[model samples]
Target: MREAAVSPSPLSPSPLSSAAAPPARPVRSPLSGRLAGLWAAAGARCALPVAVLLALGFLAPLVAIFAYSFAPPRSFDVFRAFSLANYAELFSPSNTVWLSFAWSIGLALFTCAILAVVAYPIAYGLAFLFGRWSSLVSVLFVFPLFVSENVRLYGWVLFFIKNGVLDGTLKWLGLEGAPAVLYTPGMILAGMVYTYLPFMLFPLTLGLSMVPRDLIDAARDLGANRFQIWREVEVPLAMPGILIGMLLTFVLAIGAVSEAKILGGQSVIVISHDIEIAFTYAQNWPLGSALAVLVTAFIGALTLLVFARLDLDRLLGRR
Candidate 1:
């Protein structure tokens, strides 16, 4: 049987049809997408102020200091020439710059230790026990900050010096041979601890405050004692505050020349004092700049190390 011839339908496109597949949508890279998003979020107006401020306030000074560090001896003109002579002088046996650094660092560590030990309990009490009174106590703790550092330190000087208030008080009580704390390293450390105690306390209190009471209760319910709760729960939670406080105190202590001069006099030598001497007395701006750079670099490295170990977003409540 002959089959009926089939007709080709016009509706069906042929294999060579000109009709094109929908143009493939272009894919965007993550980096470009992020940049776009950032631009959109930042806008133009908001970014200008921040950028300008950073350039003028932060970058300019930082660049100036870095340049000045390599400037030639006795000159503040960083453009003159670059030299390592200033840094090299720090290592010279007679210079004692390294010793000054060691003393500064040692004092900072001691101050941090004292602050941690003393402030932690006060902060813990404020966070957990003070209740409505915590705010008032906190205000009191920071009251010393209202006064200038110089004034506060001088007050300590009066209290600690021989034949001063403290000695007079003891003598009034009929006690003899009161130890002379003035111009001693111990007095210097005491003054530093007193000066920066508020810095440590405030950060620690903030950190301790972040810890949830519910967690402590839960730990206790799980048969954890006070020490266990502290070690396993509280300490870990408060670590960010502790780190920040200690770092702040350490940085403040090491950078202060006034404290060493006023409290320790000529006996105690810190890096800041040496830097001051280099710039003011020796008229060696380059040497002072080198010391400043060294101190700043050391502080930056330490801060970076702390931040690296911490989940900063979480610590700052940004996450």
Candidate 2:
């Protein structure tokens, strides 16, 4: 139409114009900087005490033991002279050190196996089968933990001793002359199992509890049988807990000397008892220290092995 063009007014703003952008925050306030510094300082201050305590109480002893392991026999001083005599004697073919190690380690392994078998069923029952009553059952399982360890082991002692509670009960039930189990290897193993059962069971229960119900349902919907579901789905999921339980049970069982002493009496000679004898009666601090170092190293190696097998992210459900 070629209408006559008119010039735009200078004072009017355009409707299509965008809003002004806010200014960028290029720097933090001084107060915020000071507060962050204070927080870091406070955390460091809090951690200092614990770090110092660990260094003094834990690291110092380990250092002393390691130093003493290199010392000569009958010497408490680690700095008097450095020698390999103790280690040489320790690994000597004539010594029974290896046998003692085998005995202690074998017992610990056996105990771990038993605990695994027993704990799985208990954990499964608590987490799956028991349902609403699981909490009550858990409390009952943990009730024994409230009692002193020594007292619990002593109770086992009373139960296993000749004519003690077990024998008395059996005789009362018309079973005469029950065999005494006290001070035997079997009794020691049984005591260890009773004492450490909770350790294995609790972890397995926690693991089993975390297994997805949806996964189980899906498995069932897929026509998977109970055993198949458990073996293929449940077990793989609960592996972290099983490994943790195994590690804990094995470590505790292996290091246990008091249980062996009280339950095994003079019947079985574990590496721990041998170390005790070397330390106290034989006055051979070097030998004792060497054995202690060996055990500590062995445990460290086992821990590394366990960590190697564990997927940390998967275990924590991060994956």
Candidate 3:
């Protein structure tokens, strides 16, 4: 067997060399790799400044308020002492602050309902009927916002006060004197509706604008009546804007103080007024902080619930 061994030719390849070799990978410089990573993250890096600004401007105050909320009632020793006394006091049976909460919530609800009904027609006109004049009408609506809210509210006070413009005009016209409608809950609600009407109208208009006219025409072609189209198509499409308008109106109305003060006088007390009293007149910082915390929590929870049901991608037109 040793004598039978044969010599291999130089052209013949070995078994190991018969298979194709894998290509060597190109090595990149560390600096280039680092630059690539930085470029990829450029957007997030750019956002850092805004994030810092928000943390400072918005979150910092919330953190302070939250910390103060747990402090002992009627004390400014924030972050030094922690107690549930403020909350306990608010929850106590004798506390009539609940009445203030009820008033604020009820007034806010009424304002929202009124604004929804009143703004819808106007919003519809703005979206579909006003045509080229829409911008002018919108500007007119926005013009009121530039004036001070307090000034506007005070003007209403003068107009509605006894022997003011209405009463004087009525008497001059040989008609019965104007009814004593000032300094009433009804007046406060009226003021709120007036103040928050624009907020509701604009959002509703935006939502209505999102609805495609072609789809509406198609629905009509399909024998869908006006009510059916509105219920099945328009409402579903414009829901985001409607919800946004309602939420904005509700939030502003719930925290209203000037309306109650300037119009309702002492007829009604809202939660915001109570908080102001706690912070200013009563000098109860903890109590104010607690009230603020509760209000914020309620709003946050409601907002979350709304957002949970919202199709954000659809609203944003990402889809």
Q: Considering every candidate listed, which one attains the maximal TM-score?
A: 3
Q: What is the TM-score of each candidate against the true structure?
A: 0.85, 0.86, 0.89
The lDDT per prediction is 0.88, 0.88, 0.92
lDDT by residue for model 3 (1-319), tens: 4687677888998666667656679999999999999997997899999999999999999999999999988888998999999999999999999999999999999999999899988898999899999999999989999999999999998887889999899999999889999999999999999999999999999889989999999999999999999999888999998999999999898999999999999689899999999999999999999999999999899889888887888877889
Q: Which scores better on lDDT, 1 or 3?
A: 3
lDDT of 2 at 224: 100
What is the clash count of model 2?
Answer: 0
> Of 1 and 3, which scores higher on TM-score?
3
Pitting candidate 2 against candidate 3, the one with the higher TM-score is 3
Q: Estimate, for each residue in 73-172, the C-alpha lDDT of model 1 and write its tens digit.
A: 8887787898999888887889767888999999999999999999999999998898999989989878888899888888888887788888889999
Where is model 2 more than 4 Å wrong at Cα? Answer: 1-32, 172-174, 317-319
Candidate 1: clashing pairs of residues: none
Least accurate stretch of 10 residues (summed lDDT) in model 3?
Answer: 14-23
